[model samples]
Target: MNYEFTTVGALIGLAVAIILIIKKLQPAYSLILGALIGGIIGSGSLVTTVNTMVSGGEGMISSVLRIMTSGILAGTLIKTGAAEKIAEVIVEKLGEKRALAAISLATMIICAVGVFIDISVITVAPIALAIGKKSGYHKEALLLAMIGGGKAGNIISPNPNTIAVSEAFKVDLTSLMMKNFIPAICAVVVTILLSTMLSKKQGVQVTENDLEQKEDKNLPSFIQAVAGPVVVVILLALRPVASIVIDPLIALPVGGVVCALACGQIKNIREYAEFGLGKVVGVSVLLIGTGTIAGIIKASALQYDVVHILKMANMPAFLLAPIAGILMAGATASTTAGATIGAQTFAGTLIKSGVSALSAGAMVHAGATVIDSLPHGSFFHATGGAAGLEIKERMKLIPYEMCVGLTSTVVAVMTYVI
Candidate 1:
């Protein structure tokens, strides 16, 4: 075999270094360093690489702005007690005996609203942890259940992933939704039931203290506790189904602000406006960084390199689609990317190359969630941290998530294919 310093090899090396830096260095600084190194290695020239690196650096900031904004919005919602209201109100109706059902349904509804996964986790984790503390339930088990339900919403909803896949594959959203709906819904049902049974077997249940306030002194009324945030998120989420006219994005934030005002949570319209703008900051920053990274890789011709490797293999399209999705999921730490961009980009090729559509679709779904389960994922890290799981302990969730993801894919394929 010839020893070739291919562009792909350089990019991979760059990726490895970035991962190392992420673990060690501050996030903002590490991203910059990685992009600079990527430029140098990808171009094989110093001056030209520096120029490109500068451009990439600037672009990354722009992307970060968007992600940061979104994050801030999410953070604000949590701080303002809007998100908590939604969760508690939702759980109150479920009853204690059906806690699993309550948790799953709450997760599903929240996710379907097209909220970011990290935000959703942040919103839900505290409640889940509180429940675990109260019921003597294993925190990990309950966390997994919450994550499972969220993942279901992430995969199947007409959220970013669905739209991304649709744009990439040149397929209709409604059609793909129809195709994948059954398996996605079934996966949530089965996973929740299984998690609940396991929790029960483990003798997990939230105690009265865990479920109720201790002193009840100066405690907000339950209606006051839930009204604002629930109304906002629900109105926003329901915008599409409610009217034939309004844009969902506009509606979501608008509803959030209005609810804030109506609930007397906002002192004035200016505060409401600030809350909306501020809430988007952290999320906007994250999005920008991720988008810039994707852009830099694309600019450096990474996709072509991956495609070239594929050309050498005897892999058919069906397998390739799933495999592509899996890789994308791992790289991006996003199922949304896997379903929308990964599937759209590779699914059709796989189908044309003799892969069954159902199998390809199933693989896309499987790949999307499995990658999220990895310890490297932001979702995993955030949830684990919030729940007080050490890194070593966080590994425990991996096998379960993997098993669920793999099993779900297989079942999906079987449901559609044979």
Candidate 2:
């Protein structure tokens, strides 16, 4: 009876949470609320509900601290002007007249660095806006290019998100990237060409408004900009080396602070310490909240069963991964979540059903890239808000984005299949 009740209630809670998330409610809050309610109803006891709430609160608080640290680190980078300096250096070397092309390059670079899309966006979007405005190009074009770069690059890089998915599904990131490289590269190329052509056809005029959006001049020293974050990244990549001596998580914040100091941006060591704590709290809360939802579903055994059902459907890897991602993107308006989960869920089935690891991986990549072009995506909203892009109004790039992703996936499938 308890099993039946827990299973039934979890399904209900999941549905409620999904609907609320789709309706633009905060997912973390909605999920916890749904879980609490379900727990109470399923257990039919207030004491059990209270106990769960207390534990959940502790977990959420811890996770939120993590998120806040990453956020502050990001915020400080923006405030200290180091992030701007890096973007400026890259843009200057790349040539502003080719801003869209430049964006493609930046995207590839960031992706290869293995940054999560959420963090990557916070790091890159402002820079993309600054560059596009300087180049007198439509922000829309540049932003789309940025998304294209990050989404496809995610597929090719050993980013933690994909690494998590890989671990969850028992896939190897190195092998996956190796197999998926061609399609990912081809997608970036095609995306760049299309963006450039679209920028031309739109015949968008750069007015005075564009010039006003240039980045601030209080940029950090070039060396500070270069060394700060790069060191942390290298540390993460060299996990085998770092893990032999120190914990990677400890190393990341420590490295961030070291870079912050090297950049001469740290006012005090305590401040950096506090900032890291904040990020840990915030990110951990969100992730753990998500993990809780996952836990409840797992406890009920419904989520796994549902996954098996989808797997046994025996759909083509190229089609199923992207389609699932599209549905998730539409629901959550977040390609990060959509693509991450979609890849995890589909990877096993896709591989078992005869899809090469690389081909299947590309399908996941294609889904994220295409869905993000939709006007409803968080990237679209955030970029448009920050950049003031009004080229042919909102969501004008959807059709074009869809075509690019679809075509790119087809190419990826062929490359892997043959």
Candidate 3:
């Protein structure tokens, strides 16, 4: 293979993938097509391209399994009413005067405990809408608050993006998450401030018609609602705190079981597991597609080109991960895909350039959060619809979302580089 041709092929392939995603193609298909184009151009062999794609996807099985297993916990929290219970408690404690902050913090806590960001938004939407109507806050403000909090929590959460980056960089998941703690907190603070200001400025209250009421049922006690996430956190913490190693693959399902037991929904564990699996299937496929792209890039000279460019510009080495992350996530409009592709493609280069694996992984994870909520991605639509916002209102929230993401990225850079 000609090194220069491989580099150009890799770059073009990535560009083509981004274009496809922007054109409304599903991420999985876009990534796979791009990988094929790049591999064929780089190696000039059909068999080799297929082989590379398969090999790349095959390597992601562990990550895929971990993501799938995490569904168990997600399902338990969402289905058993624990997540709602948790949100309700937070809102009640804070009261209407602090509704924006309460909803933001509620979504953050829900997502930080391993719930998917989209699911977290959906789970908290009703509560946020209800609070908004009562507090005279704009619908846009409440939605933005949820998005900001979810993004903040997602950076340090045991979510798919974190899992993919950890595996890509060969870093301890818990350690990488710990490294993101300060940045996540900073993002939360930024979210609170921005949301509060937006609410005050707009004052276009959500109407009663916008509220979606859930069926009346007895919610699990606050203690029960908190128990599952607490158990998972303890298991994950044991690795760094006590020299015990429990993979997220094990800890997540165990936490789900604990959550179910505490919530008295253990009898319906199978149903919850199925529900969780359904939610994750799409993302699982997207990750495999991302892996194929990563493999093609890794096999090319693109990393060398990037390094040379950075050196010529005299930029700090730590900026590489974040730059890649922001670009990819902005292009794809999906944080996990962006973070995974960036980490897998550039982690080796970042490590070779004298950056530690944990730092590289943490930086990339934080960077992806910056633009993952762009309009092109499903998250933008899913979350907006969940919050009952129309296309125009949803569009208005982009800058604020970016601000929250930027806060996390800047904090990551300051913490890990200079």
Q: Which has the higher TM-score value, candidate number 1 or candidate number 3? A: 3
> Top TM-score: which candidate number?
3
**lDDT of each residue in 1-418, candidate 3, tens digit only:** 2342288888788888988988999889999999899878775488877787788898788899999999999999999999999999999999998888899899999999989999999999999998787777888889888999999889888889999999999888889988999999999899999998887675446777788765777889999998999998999999999999999999999999999999998999999999999989999999999988888887788878888888899987778989989988887899999999899888878997899899888889999998888887899999989977788889888999999999999999898866
* Per-residue accuracy of model 2 over 1-418 as CA lDDT, tens digit each: 1232265666676567667765767766766666566665554355655455455345333323333444434444545556556656666787877777677767665555434444455566666766665666675577667766666676665444444344434444445555556766777787788878777666444455544455447666878765646665565545344444332334345555665786676775456556545534433444445544443443443434554666699743346666755654454455544454455445655676676665566566556556654443455665555456563554776676676666656666677557
Q: What is the TM-score of each candidate against the true structure?
A: 0.69, 0.70, 0.97
Cα deviation in Å at residue 298, candidate 1?
Answer: 2.3
Taking the tens digit of each residue's C-alpha lDDT, what string does model 1 give over 1-418? 1112335634664475458534755433444455556655564465655554455445444323333333323433444555556666677787665666677667765665445555676677667767667556676677667777777666654445544454345444434444565666766786676677667554334444434343433323445544444554454334345643333344345544544554465554455456546645533443333333343454555545565677779533345555666665665555653344355445545666676664565567655776655655466788676556678766766776665565556555666456
**Ranking according to lDDT, highest score first:** 3, 2, 1
Off by over 4 Å in 2: 1-15, 33-76, 107-136, 153-184, 213-216, 240-247, 268-283, 299-326, 339-377, 390-392, 401-418
Model 3 residue pairs with clashes: none
The stretch of ten residues in a row with the least summed lDDT in candidate 1 is 63-72
